[model samples]
Target: MATETPTSGSADGYYDFHDHDDAAHLHALGYQSEFKRDMSPWANFSLGFTYLSPVVGVYTVFAFALATGGPPMIWAFVLAGLGQLMVALIFSEVVAQFPVAGGVYPWARRLWGRKYAWMTGWVYIIALLVTISSVVYGAGPFIASVFGFTPSVDTTIACALGLLVLATIINFMGTSVLAKAAIIGFTAELVGALVVGAWLLIAHREQSITVLFDTFGTEGDSGSYLPAFAAAALIGVYQYYGFEACGDVAEEVKDPGRLIPKAMRQTIYIGGAAATFVCLALVLSVTDIGAVVSGEVTDPVSAVLEEAFGTVGARAVLVIVLLSFLSCAMSLQAAASRLLYSYGRDDMIMGSSLLKKFSPTRHIPPYALVVSAIVPAIIVIGSRVSENAITKIISFATLGMYLGFQMVILAALRARLKGWVPSGKYTLGAWGLPVNIIALVYGVIAMVNMAWPRTPDAAWYDNWIVALSGVIVVAVGLVYMAIHPLHDRSTAPYDDAIPKK
Candidate 1:
């Protein structure tokens, strides 16, 4: 990485944050948000699209819809998938411009102002924690099912907390360390998803393609044709979420302005196509929904494999999934830590002085990683009280992530409309206006689907206990702000100069 360079005066130009951050800016007494750029553009892109991308996001709802919404689940997936493209385009626009660590927050900050940026940042932060809870909570049964080793809820919580701790350590080691592990873990997740998908496709070659593509039908507790189909598309939307991770880590890439946008476009196309193929393989492979959903079969992909292959064969696949998901949890925790580190530098948390303490030797935000682990550890404990509540909370919390995503699009739109930033190395330029409008429309629709309460049996309403946390966290942020007036010029949420953070 290059050394820090001071401010440059433009003889003829107006104001703008410098196009890049200096690595030496990271060396400070209590602040360390700077990241070393070492990732290849491909790794940068796939890491987001691969690991934390939710398979359950696709499966949980669509599975529920299978019975009633006979074949139209494909349509749901199709439309929702298209909706995601709107958000993805927005990100393509932003990362091409500001390529900073504070993705949605930065864009919102640059567009709306500091206060709004902080609110968006906090919402995204809590949302990330809630998703962490869901991912860990869901991973538990897979561990037990594959190993035939059972543990009480309390023990499961401990294991989950331990995993959180491990991830915290890995992430705190440094951006390079975290990024390297992500590459390996991402490769595993990609291979695992494909191998299982391919096996199912080959085994179920006899099923009619028309069963999936021919028509749409209502399955299970799904209400009406159009609404249920709308809800089902949501499943695919969830699975493909998180590819914007490429944008958040752009500051850590060698030539973020160029590479980030390239990765952004490729990640979506590659990840989207891969997921489409997997879903096709999966729906075709299923012989009976009744047998699959009968038990606590959380790892449905593995379950399908087991049905096709023998018990021993399926168990091996289950092991692969268990390991893969565990790594995903680790990767997500790392991202959460860095995001919190950025927030801390911006004085979003109390004792802002402490949270940004970077390790001199390791080049990491140790305190920020520690802070990131605390809420999640508590969440892991809370999960024991009610597994269903935890899962619902995570799902509901994901809406904040969706909100963050929308802001990124909003930022890109603002940049194009206002023409305030530098001419970015990459751009939507002319297409920016139309793309942002479509993205905003789709974002609103998806949020409503998530917000709309469904029947108690429907996945939307099924785990609602956890979903309310988004409101709770936002309310908490307000209360916290009231107590400690929000002023931290040293770590201004936006406004370049890299803050004093």
Candidate 2:
């Protein structure tokens, strides 16, 4: 068991050696996981894409839409999907080439350099941590629904923390446990979507197909169907997130690069289709958007389910919600641990050595898992969950992760475009340049839109909390960088898969 490396750096430790890093540091945290080859591609896809975080995505897109509008929010989720697609495809290209722990940060380093890459990593890790908070907090309503009682914030907090502890225990058990969790998570999530989706399609009698393009040829601020589409798309974007969790455990997978990339992409597309259908069902089933809106002020899904199917439907969705929340909680803790471990190994985190240390018996970062929950236990304390706040925080992190996502894609795209990096069997081919350009532009836009203050879009005080969490996290990372100063003394060598100039 490794303890974190001391935060103290020496003043007299500057030395130059002209040897390039072997770059094992790039992969050692088990990043670009090699163990994936052991599983079938479907398992790979399921594991990579399915998990607890996607639930967070659903909450993000749907709730955000609901808050902004009403059932019309379905259209907004669709737009969100389009926004995410640009990044997904581009991210696909980058991961195909440089499947490293730093992911986007490494890509940025290659595109820009180490300094810029470090900045992005700082943001990415913090974003991930914030996401952990949101996932746990958001799981509450569902937990309450399953048991036939409303859980107070205190009860909800305990449940979430307990969920994290159990997840951590399973995580400490190793890849096999993760695979099992993925299978269960996949079944629960997909099947849940199927039930909900089928209900919307078959059970939903209204042929509101016009809602799809309701205002394309017509117009008015009376809820332009276009914005609704955009809203639905964006919400879809939220649901499709955490697809990268599969790749984070690259070391445990057999054919890490190929399977992880394929899985990551597959999860996005499948999750997208499933999410859209579910959104449609919920919107269609609602008899009175205004009444449902007012009634669901606290728990929208519960409100809509009750409104739609009465006692039976509400109860059923409650059970599903419990399943979904558990799935997300497990997957989230796993992903966050890897991120923390990644940053620690690089000493970007203060106690890198300790946090990155793997359990000799478990082959997992037990300490990392413990710390992961400990950090968020605060949220479990007295606080108005502000599920929207949680969503924004996740979105906030998603943007940070996007920076890492964008940087790497830019590097791979530049290499492929310039013929700098050797073309691989999986290269993006002729579509590389054009597709990459589109993705980069979309990424920049997404980041800017996310960062822009949207008081009209969110609760003023809650938004302030979300923004504050991200800012403080990033600022601390910068301060850590200034104090630590990179040193060659302890860093493990990098591998040849990554280039060192």
Candidate 3:
């Protein structure tokens, strides 16, 4: 592995190295100071926020939720928000203790061992890459809507590829540009959510608040609203993620141990609020809620927005949504590249040397960034063969992330049971054990909810794809690990990074 002597301070003193505090912390955890630490607290927060991307998350899945469970689906946001807050809290505890890039991968490694960490990283990296594809594909129609063009499969694929290329360029520009773009995207999404939501509530609302409780007779095969509601809850499940992006870029953020945990919580708090408000506003503004539930109007959010605002007004909103999509793709790519870099830095993967190479001038992992972009672009192109490409791709992303999350949380729980105690500045104190258990429960429930085959009338693949895909991903990772075990396990020494009392 390449090594650099830890410097005492930056020339301008902008970094205030303080006896190489950050470098020391990283070295204690078996890593060198490879990434440039330019991210401020807000920048770190912005990366997580943009990855969550309320506008993109809600807009992309809005119509599907409305069609599945009608106005009552809005409550899914509330339930999901509470559930995910538990997961985020658990994440904060681990991230504060480890404060490593690649998020769950390194966390699991420290808590468990090499095999667990390998699977965690493998699943997470795949999820992050596919999430880039999902976000780009989700944005395609909004871009088309803004330009007044019809979104056919051909057009959507073209738009998705264009987005992948643009986001890759921003990532290659390095952390500073990525941070600035995240802040810009966050501002647009926040402002758009508040302004659009308030307008829809004040000027366009045609339904009562009570409307959110009505299922409109859309129950599942069991003839119970419970099953359909579980399926519809996917909207909220999908949105609350991406907060882990903060941990993925931990090495790039200043004072990460102190700041990343707070940033993770804030991402969920702010994102959950914005998403709930916007989804509620859209549901309430619908003139004919039955039409939406019955699939008479497939894209209910757009239909309502066009009706509430005039054509020009709706087009303006579409532009804001498009920006959110662009930023979402950018953040996903950035996080994925960092995960690749982390795996490579530890010599865990096949192309460690190349993947771990940092561009001296750019101070970023150029090859990893390129691989990140290419994989997602290929996924987008290949998805064109599927009739329900968007839904299935989104399912893959949500399932993959949940599986990765559960693995890390489970590892942490086991470690805790075995007398592990957090040594970070932000330990959860007396609440750690309870929170970790609850978080694991929520993760399991959410994963099953997302992977459950809900569409009985659709083709078998459409129904079972999420569960089957998840199994296939796990199997592939295990096969690779069995054939080619990691070259070195010396980093296991750093397990002492979290000292036992």
Best by lDDT: 3
Clash count of each predicted structure: 14, 55, 0
lDDT per residue for candidate 1 within 1-501, as digits (tens), equals: 111122332311111226344242222112234456666776676557644453434433445445434455756556766777767766765555455575676666655566667777778877777767666666665566666767568667766676666667667677777677777666665665677778777775436787775333343454446665655555565665666677767656776666766666666666666666666777777665444345333344555666877778877776666556666666566666667666666666677677656676776668767766788778778766664554355457657788777765665556455554334455455566777889888887777667655556756534353345556777887777678756444345353312212
lDDT of every model, 2 decimals: 0.61, 0.57, 0.84
TM-score of 3: 0.94
Per-residue alpha-carbon lDDT of candidate 2 for residues 149-267, written as tens digits (9 for 90 to 100): 77776777777777666766676777667777767777878766777657656765344655543322222355454443443344544565666666666555544445566676677
Q: Is candidate 1 or candidate 3 better by lDDT?
A: 3
lDDT of 1 at 375: 82
The Cα error of candidate 3 at residue 478, in Å, is: 0.9
Model 1, runs deviating above 4 Å: 1-34, 51-71, 150-159, 213-223, 290-300, 411-422, 456-468, 488-501
- What is the TM-score (0 to 1) of candidate 1? 0.84
> RMSD, model 2, all Cα superposed?
8.0
Candidate 1 residue 467 Cα shift, in angstroms, is: 6.8
What's every prediction's RMSD, in angstroms? 5.4, 8.0, 5.2
